[model samples]
Target: MIRPSIPDRSDDPRVDVSLVVNGEKVMRPVSIRMLLSDFLRHELGLTGTHVGCEHGVCGCCTVHIDGKAGRSCLTLAVQANGAEIRTIESVAHQDGALHPIQQAFKECHALQCGFCTPGMVMNILARFEEEEKLDLSDSGIRDMLSGNLCRCTGYINIIAAVRRAAELLGRA
Candidate 1:
């Protein structure tokens, strides 16, 4: 039997939201209470934006919203209307070439389980894009990456990869 759409509760009405995702314009009907994380993962099939802590603590749901990284778990799909959202899927080139950051992560062995890599990379991208002079100092890098949590790798190579990514980005 075909499943019918669930009725929207009064407090959770459906609304249309428009956003440019990964360089493509998209519009979808989403429940007003739908979190951006869910909208991106379920509705749009972009699973790279992982939702770790639904409360936004783990930072696994980070995404670039209008050129800045924001916790998708805390952002509503309706609130993202008319926004430009970038997910980790956009980090790679269309011809299967890994973006420099991705290559750095791979070559440096920055990821283990890889659950947090997407958010981590997006956060790094946000910092690099927003800052005038990229600071890769230990303390500076720690402060920028403090929000993202990874249980593996002990962050040794991740830090190294971030530094390497900075160099790669600088060469561009």
Candidate 2:
């Protein structure tokens, strides 16, 4: 027998929200039940922030919230009111150039299928920023990316890419 899925309750209490996304302030009215991932993808049109597992286990929906890495799927948009959000699309350089991490990912062929690349890159960027003195060790890279699962490339390329990015950033 097949089970039926429950409908999303989108007609709940409405709330006014204002937050910084990709360095720009966005103000709008949203339902309290709206997930931050949906707000970024559907409302803000930032599809780079992917949603792999809606329950936040996959880490594919990772984003920067107030300078820390967080799972947008698990966070409510209303909770992000008055906060700062940074998606994968904003990680590029001011001149529209790829960020060092992104560049390394491309050069090292870190991704296949590309579904999990955005979240991996975003988490790496956030962690790199926080741990300013981080040295990209093999085990360390694996540990850092433990939350993100990629079914392609066997993760060797991803690790190599992160190491290359760290070298470029002078962190390795």
Candidate 1's displacement at residue 169, Å, is: 1.7
Residue-wise C-alpha lDDT for candidate 1, range 54-158, written one tens digit per residue: 888888899999999999999999999999999999989999998888988998999999999999999988888898886678887888899999977788889
Worst 10 residues of 1 by lDDT: 1-10
Query: Which parts of model 1 are misplaced by more than 4 Å?
Result: 1-11
The 10 consecutive residues of candidate 2 with the worst lDDT sum are: 1-10
Tens-place lDDT per residue, model 2, 134-161, is 6567888899999898977689999999
Q: Score each candidate by Cα lDDT.
A: 0.88, 0.90
Cα displacement (Å) at residue 66, model 1: 0.4
Taking all chains together, each candidate's TM-score versus the true structure is: 0.91, 0.92
Against the true structure, whose TM-score is highest?
2
Q: lDDT score, residue 1, model 1?
A: 25
